[model samples]
Target: MKNQNFVRNLVGTAILAALVLALQLLLGSLKLGPFNITLTLVPIILGAVLYGPLSAAFLGGLFGFLVCISVISGNDAGGFMLFSQKPVITLALCMIKSTAAGYLSGLVARSLSKKNATLSLFLAAGIAPVVNTGIFILGLLLFFQDTLVLWANGQDKVIDFLLFSILGINFTTEFLVNLVLVPVLARILRNLRFVKQELAV
Candidate 1:
């Protein structure tokens, strides 16, 4: 039973990872200002709620790596050159942001499961995007503020362009996407037999 459960979780994680990758690719093509609002974190959130932190983090890291590679290869829709400017730094930030979001989602869900399953899932899904985008914004402010200010074209009044970018665009985009999709996805996943059987306990 133990081995079987492990295998099941592994397979589920792989499938979720692929789904995240596909979503990222598709969403990357669509631009809504600075936020290319994507459902990429949905799978990671689901994985975290169903499996555990490590699995969730692994899937998040995997997706982040793929995104970094895509950026490096100039496949991103924005063509912002996020990876080209500072490859290692960009990759590290992506990995850290994604993994932390995933891990936290799982931890929060697990802690809240006994009280309210729906609320737990809701929190898990909702928190991931905030964390992911928040970290990205912070990293930009810390490392790439100068470039961001130049790109702002004087429209933003904030001294730190990164801060303005987050408040102005990134947070809104992330909030809108996650708000619309997370609840729906969480409800659907809760109904799945595997999820109910393995995760609801």
Candidate 2:
């Protein structure tokens, strides 16, 4: 079982990491306005629910890596511009928030599922976007408050700036998307005997 666990973790992580990259690169841009509407969060959240926190972290890191590549390769002009201005800090923000969100989602879901799995799934799904956005907003505050304000052009107040410019529809859509997809996908995944075995292992 220990060996099974180790193999399962490795294999599962690889598969999910691939999924994250594929969805982002193959499916074309999911961006709207100043935001990149994310499609990869589903896989990260799924890994968290099915595999474990470590697997989730691995998937999240892969997601970040792909994003980094996308930016560096000049596939995303806005991302590349941001990376040009604040390379290290921007990369850190991307990786840290996503990685933490993935790990936290798995930890929360796994813990809560021991008591109430239905509630656990929703809670876990719901938490990731909040954490993701929260960390992003915090990162802006910590690393780019002046940049943000300058971009906002001093028209909007801080809270209003965050809501309108930052979170806005992208945040709502991401949250709702996760809320709907995570549970539905989890239900499908639950029927898979292999997924169950991996989880149990």
Candidate 3:
């Protein structure tokens, strides 16, 4: 039984990882400004709700790695600009934000599940993109402020430019995806017999 659970988890993790990779590669070029639309957050949230924090972190790390690749390859113009200016910090920011997103989503969901499972799932899903984008914004402010100013093109408020021009669409899409999709899909998976048994354990 233990081995069976292990196999099931391994396979599930692999599937989610593959989904993340495919989404990142396929929609990776679709950027509103400097950031990708981030269709992968759904799977990351799913992994968090189902497999656990570690799996979610793994998925998020994979996403970070892919983003790094895109930046290095000059596919993500904003990210590439940051990378060109501050290579190590850009890399660290990329990795840390998404990783923290995934890990926190899972940890929060698991922690809150005892009181209300559904609410916990929704919160978990909601928090993933929040953490992801929030940290990215902070990273920009802390580490990439000058670049932001350049991108702002002498705008009166760089924060306005960042919030409205750069991140508005990207953050909305990611947030809505996690909000609508994660709950429905997680409920479906939780209804499955094997998953029910695993959760019970």
Instruction: Write the residue-wise lDDT of candidate 3 on 1-201 in tens digits.
Output: 999878877888898899899989986445576667778888888888777899899999999999889889998888889999899999899899899999999898788777777777888988998899889889888888788788787647797887786567778787888788887776677676424423321
TM-score of each: 0.83, 0.89, 0.90
Candidate that scores best on lDDT: 3
> Candidate 3's error at 107, in angstroms?
0.2
Best by TM-score: 3
lDDT of 2 by residue, 18-93 (tens): 8888898897247776557887899898888878888888888878778788877777765676778899888887
User: Candidate 2, residue 95: CA error in Å?
Assistant: 1.1
Answer with 1 or 3, whichever has the higher lDDT: 3
Give the per-residue lDDT of model 1 (tens digit) for 1-201: 999889978887888888887888766334555545556777788888888788889978887787677666766643245566777888798789988999998899889877887778778877888888888878866876665665666536545454555555665666676656666665666676546543442
lDDT of 1: 0.72
Model 2 scores a TM of 0.89
TM-score head-to-head 1 vs 2, winner? 2
lDDT of 3 at 104: 99
- Name the 10 consecutive residues with the lowest summed lDDT in model 3: 192-201
Predictions: Cα RMSD each: 3.0, 2.7, 2.6
After aligning candidate 3 to the native by TM-score, how far in Å is the CA of 182 from where it should be? 1.0
The Cα error of candidate 1 at residue 73, in Å, is 1.4
Residue clash pairs of candidate 3: none
Shift in Å, residue 50, candidate 1: 1.5
